[model samples]
Target: MWWKTARTRLDLGQRGMIMGILNTTPDSFSDGGSHAGVEAAVAHARQMIADGAAIIDIGGESTRPGAGEVAVAEEIARTAPVIAALRAEWAGAISIDTMKASVAAAALEAGADIVNDVSGLTADPDMERVCVESGCGVAVMHMQGDPRTMQVAPDYEDVVAEVRRFFEERLLSLVAAGIDAEAICFDPGIGFGKTVEHNLALLRALANLNVGGRPLLLGVSRKSFIGRVLGSTDLADRSWPTVAITAWAREAGAMIHRVHEVRPNTQALRMTEAILQGGNSAFSG
Candidate 1:
């Protein structure tokens, strides 16, 4: 499983890939304003790269549930400069986490390699054209509703099956719009519009998604669903659960993990990889 852009290539399934989340917003549920400025966001990207991140997912808008949308011009202003700086100095994959077409286009021009659209390419009709023209890697995620109202009533009958159907439909749409199938990845959109049970079921049934061998990306890092499960509303308390999920999901066939704290998640994935590769005991060798 190789994810390729004109400027980047990722060998998926060789090991779990960590996508460090850098939110340049004041309202993301976790670590929002910490890197809202160009300088700060660039510094954080450098740190994530040094910390073993294979990809940096930069978002200018907060997609956290009930979060208001940022204007396209504002979104571009927030992310493009950071992306440009990172591209000038860094040589790793950079993903523009936005649903708007203009923001994605600007980021690509400024040196982003992937379009991680939380809207699953359904937000702006022009999104498909921008991605097709740029030939960047695209991550189409399933959100049950818009950010503001998604959490208010995330209802589903057999959530896993429904999400798989969503992927099936979207994959066709994206391919028809001229995206190479090899450059496409699927994210079940955990916590996007899911209740706790919905999120867990999707994680459990990942192998069952019939996406024709595309990589499955999971981004449950410090999400509210984790808090709900752990009975802790605090964002900081979700790290352990986040790392635990990374290990568990990797074993369950998750090829990529989008996380905020990269080092711990990287360690967890490494340990899981070692164990899976038969490095279970000190004396085994």
Candidate 2:
């Protein structure tokens, strides 16, 4: 399978790809204000690239539960410069993670190749048109509600079926709106509005959510759900659980893993892929 973006096409069937997260905000649940400026963000991107990130996902607005909205101009300012600098230094894949069309437009103009909208192009009126026109890869995620109130009282009769239906509906609409089917992928929106049970159910049903034969993008990187499952709030404790899930998701045929910590997840992905490929007698143990 191949994923076609504006600037590049990824061979998803070859191996699982890691999308490094670069949150350029002060309020993101994890790593907010950690890489806020272009210099720091670029430095982190370089590290992630060296550590095996196939794509660098830059986000300005914090989508954490109850996160307040940032202005479009503010979002652009936080993301565009880092995207431009990364485009200048390296030609690898870069994604702008935003819900607003205007911020996505600025990021695309600044050299982003994909729009990783957590809203799945529903938050903004013009998101679909902008994506269709730009030819950038689209990641349509399933969130029960907007970030500010998503987790307030999230509910679903059947989480897996609802998400599956959401993906099916999105696939048809996105293709009808002129996006190439191959240019689109589906994300189950792990913790956006989900409880621990909901998140686990989605992970267990990862392979079943790939509607329209499109790839699935998994982003369980140190999310609160992980910490909750492990009975720990410390980010450090969530690291290995994150890696384990990365391996699990890959074995389940997930094409991409969006993660905050790149190196360990990259290692987990490579090891899982190698093991699944078979015929490697190099390890006798």
Candidate 3:
């Protein structure tokens, strides 16, 4: 399968892609405020590209549980410069991770190639138009509710089936609104509003969420669910589980893995792909 972005086409059938996370906000759950300035953000993006990241996902607002909304202007001020610089510096795909159309528009003008909306294009009515107008790639995620209230009493009778149905409905809506089906991707929105059990169920059944034959993007790197499951709050302790899931999800046919630590996860994904591709007897254990 191929995902067509504004600037590049990703052939997902070949191998899994790593999307390095660049949180421009000061409050993202992990690695926030580390690349607050444009120079620092661009430098980090360069390094991630060298580290084998296929895409750079830049977000200016913190969507962590209980995080408040950022003003549109503030969000634009934070992300646009970084995206602009990276667009000029790097040739890989650059995605603007925002829920607001205004911010998305600014980023696109400044040189972003895709829109990764956490709201699934439902938060701002204008976001869809921005994407359609620019002909950029989109990742519509399944979030139970807004960041402030998503984790509060989150419930799902059948989480996997429910998310699959959501993807089906959104695909139709987006296509009808002029977005190409091939330009769209699906994300299960892990930890967005899920309990640990819900997240685990979705992870285990991730292959079932591949609706309309579009590619699936999994973003479980260092998420709170990993912490809760491992009984640890330190973010550093979750990398092993994160890499393990990266391999498992890739084996399950996920096309993209959004991660904070790019190098190790990239190496792990390469190894997993090699194993799944079947090896010579000499390389077998």
lDDT of each: 0.89, 0.91, 0.91
Tens-place lDDT digits, model 3, residues 1-285: 999899888888867889999999888888878999999998998888888899999999999999988999999999999998998877889999999999999999999988999999999999999999999999999999899999998899999999999999999999999999999999999999899999999989988999999999999989988988889999888998999999899988898999998888888788888888774212111
- Model 3 stretches astray by more than 4 angstroms: 279-285
Task: State how far residue 281 of model 1 sits from its true place (Å).
Answer: 14
Clashing pairs for model 2 are: none
lDDT of 1 by residue, 159-253 (tens): 98899999999888889889999888999999888889998899899888749789999999988888888788788899999999999999888
Alpha-carbon RMSD, candidate 1: 2.7
True lDDT of residue 204, candidate 1: 90
Evaluate residue 192 in candidate 2 and report its C-alpha lDDT on the 0 to 100 scale.
Answer: 87
Candidate 3: count of backbone clashes, pairs at least 3 residues apart or interchain: 0
Give the runs in model 2 whose Cα sits over 4 Å from its true position: 279-285
All candidates: CA RMSD (Å): 2.7, 2.3, 2.6
lDDT of 2 by residue, 60-162 (tens): 9999998899999999999999999999989999999999999999999999999999999998989999999999999999999899999998899999999
Q: Cα deviation of 150 in candidate 1 (Å)?
A: 0.5
Residue 137 alpha-carbon offset, candidate 2, angstroms: 0.2
